[model samples]
Target: MSETIAFIGLGNMGTPIAKNLIASGYTVKLYNRSPEKVKGLVALGGHSASTIGEAVKSADIVITMLSDDHAVNAVSEEILPALKRGSIHLSMSTIKADTSKQLAEKHEARGAVYLASPVMGRPPAAEARQLFILLSGDAAAKEKVKPVLSAISQRTFDFGDAPYTSHTVKLMMNFMIFTIVELLSEVMLMAEKSGIDKNILLDTMLNTIYGAPVVKIYGPLIIKEEDNPNGFGTQLANKDLRLAQETASEVGAQLPLAEVVRTHFEAIIAAGGGKKDLPMLVSYLREQSEEVVK
Candidate 1:
C-alpha cells in the first residue's frame, strides 16, 4: 500500500503540487482554510478534510505551503497534537531559519518528524513540477519523503541534518531575487529616461552577458507596465524580504541592498501595488522618473 499524504494550504502553488501528487498515484488528503478551494481537488479524486487535524490524522506525510511564519506556526501548533508519532511534516514555505528550527524541535518533541523543504519557483513552476526544493532534516526522514518530493520538484538539494538550513538558504535566494527586481527596475527606468525603448534595451541586455531566465521572464512584464494578473504578489515578496532582513539582523550581518529592496517594496505597497505582481516595481520606478522630469 502507498503512503497516504495530507497537504495543507491550497494556494496557487500548493494546489498544483497536490494535483501533481494525485496524478503521481499518492492518496492525498487536502485542507484549506477556504473550504471552497478544496472542492476542485475532491472533484479530481482527492479526499478533503474539514480541518488540519482531520486531514493529517491517518497520513504518513503532511506538507504545508503556508504564506509566512505566523501561518506556519499556527497550523503546525494546531496539527502537532493530532499527527501520529514518527510521521513526517514537511514545510515548504519561505520562513525564518529560527522559526524553522524551533518548529523542528517542537514537532520532534511531540514524536513527529519535521523537515524544512522550502521550494524555489512560482506557480507556473509548481504546475510544471519543475521546482527546485532545498531540504534539510534527518536523513531517514528525508529518504522517506523523497518520492513525494520527487513528484512535485524536478530536483531536491539536501542540506542534511539541520532542518533550518533550508530556510536560511531560501531567504538568501529570495534576497537575490528581490535585488534583481530592484536593479532591473532602476536600469529600465534609466534607459527609458535616456530616450531608449524599454523593449529594445531588454533585448540588448538579453543578448549580452547579464542575461538569464530571471531577466528574460520578468523583463517584458516590467517593460509593458502590466501590473495585474499576479503570479507572486507584492505582499508575499515583502514578507520574505522582511524575514530576510530580520534574519540578517539576528546574525549581525549587514544587508544594505536588502534593506533598500525592502524599502522599495514597502513603498510600492504604500502606493497600492501590494496586490500587484512584484515586477510592478518597475511601474513605481517609471513614476518616480516622470516626477523628476516635472
Candidate 2:
C-alpha cells in the first residue's frame, strides 16, 4: 500500500511483529522506551526514531503495541500532535474497551483513523507470523491496512466497525484462556494428589473432546511445571482478567468464574509469581496445597 509505518513498543510481541513488517518490505520507523530494542530492529533494516513525534510525523500508518492503557495514553500525546491527517493509528494492545473508544473518538476529532486490532497468540506465534488478529474500525482504513496486517498475522477477523468490539473480543478470549488455565491447575493437582498420572490424563484429555489449543499448548507446561518463557506473566494475565471483569460488569453480564480466576491470579502475583509464566498457576496451587497439608 506504499505506507510508512511507525512501530512503537518493542517488547516481546511487538519486536517480532515489527520484524515481520520489515521482512514484508515495509518502511518501518521504530520507537521504544528502551534503545537496545530499537537497535536490534535497526540491525534488521528498520529506521530508528529519536522520539515518538519523529516516528509519527512522517508515517502513513502508526502502530502502538504498548503494555497497558497508561502506556498507550502517554504515546498518544506524542503521536496525536505529529500524526498526519488521514493517517491510520492502529492499536494492537490488549487494552480496555473504554480506552480504545476514547482513542477512536480523539483520532476522529483529529481527522485520523483509529483501529483496534488486538491479537491472539503468544510471543512465539508473533515471531512466526501466525498470530490471529481481531480488527474493528473505519472500513476504509481497515482496507488500507489489510496488507500490513496480513504480513504479520495468520488471519485477520473483522468485528464490524466499532473500535471497541475488537478489544471486547480479545478480553473475552483472554478470560476464557485464564479460566481454563485455572481449572486445569485445580484438576491436574487433584489428579496428582490422588496418585493419578497427570501426563496420561492430560494426554487423554488433549486427544479427546477437550482437545483445544488452550489445553494442548498449556497442558504440558503445567504438567512439567515449566514456566511461560514467551507468552506472558501472571501479573499481565491478572490485568487482562481485571479488564474482562470490568467489561462484563459494564455490559451488565455475569462472569462469576472470571472473578474467581482473577483472585487466583492476584494471589499468584502476591506470592511473587508475578513474573513467572501463566502455567505457574499450577505450581502456585500445588504449593498452597502443600502448605495446607503441612
Candidate 3:
C-alpha cells in the first residue's frame, strides 16, 4: 500500500502541490484554515479534514506550506502530537532558521522526522511541477519522501543532515532575489527617466549579462508593473526579507544591500502596496521620485 499523505496550509503554493500529489496517484488528506480552499481541494478528489490534528492523524507524510513562522508554529502545535511514530513532517514554508531547529528537535523528541524543504518558485512554478526544492534533514527521511518530492518539484537539492541548513539557504536565496529586484528597479527607473524605452532596455539587458531566469522571467513583469496577480505579495516578500535580516544578525553577517531592499519594501507596504507583487517596487520608486517613466 502507498503512504497516505496529509497536506496542511492550502494557500496558492500548497494547493497546486497537493493537486500534483493527487494527480501522481497518492492519497492526500488536506486541511486549510479556510473552508473554501479545503472545499476546492476536495473537489479535485482530495480528502478533507476539519483540523490539523485530524489531518495528520493517520498519515505517513505531512507537508506544511504555511505563510510564516507564526502560522507554522500554530499548526505544528496541533500536528506534532497527532503525527504517528516514524512519520515525516515536511515543512515547505520560508521560516526562520531558529524555528526550523526548534521544530526539528520537537519532532525528534516525538519520534517523528522533520524535513525543512522550502521551495523556490511562485504559484505558476508549483502548478507546473517545476519548483526547485531546497531540502535538509535526516538522510533516511529525505529518501522516504523522494517520490512525493519528485511529484511536486522539478528537482531537489540536498543540504546535508542539519534541518536548519535548508532554512538558512532559503533565506539567502530570498535575500538575493529581493536584492536583484531592488537593483533592477533602480536601473530600470533610470532608463525610463533618461528617455529610453524600458522594454528596449530590458531586451538589451536580457540579451547580455542579465540573461538568467530572474531577469528573463521577472524583468518583464517588473517593467509591466504586474501586481501580485500570481500570489507573491509584497508583504510576503517583506516577511522573507525580515527573516534574512534576522538570520544575518544571528550569524553576525552584514547585509547592507538587504537592508536597502527592506527599506524599499517597507515603504511599498506602508503606501498600500502590501498586496502587490515584489516586482511592483518600481511603482513605489516612481511615486517617490515623482518623475515620469517615459
lDDT of 3 by residue, 1-294 (tens): 298999998888998999999888888999998878888778778999988889899999999999999999999999999989999999999999899999999999999999999999989999999999999999999999999999989999999999879989998998888888888888898888898898989989988878878777788888888776666788999999898988899899988898788888888788777888888888888777884534
Error of 3 at 256 (Å): 0.1
- Candidate ranking under TM-score, highest first, comes to 2, 3, 1
Residues 1-294, model 2: lDDT tens digits: 478999999998999999999989999999999988998789988999999999999999999998889999989988999989999998999999899989999999889999999999889889999999999999999999989999999899999899889999999999999998898989999999999999999988988869999898788888888785666888888888888888889999989998788887888888777888988888788888999999
Off by over 4 Å in 2: none
RMSD of 2: 1.2
Per-candidate Cα RMSD to the true structure, in Å, reads: 1.5, 1.2, 1.8
Candidate 1 regions with alpha-carbon error over 4 angstroms: none
Error of 2 at 235 (Å): 0.8
Put down candidate 1 lDDT per residue, 185-221, tens digits, no spaces: 8998888878999888889999986688788877887
Q: List TM-score per model, in order.
A: 0.95, 0.97, 0.96
Top-lDDT structure, candidate number: 2
lDDT of 1: 0.89
Misplaced by over 4 Å in model 3 are 291-294
- Report the error of model 3 at residue 279, Å: 1.4
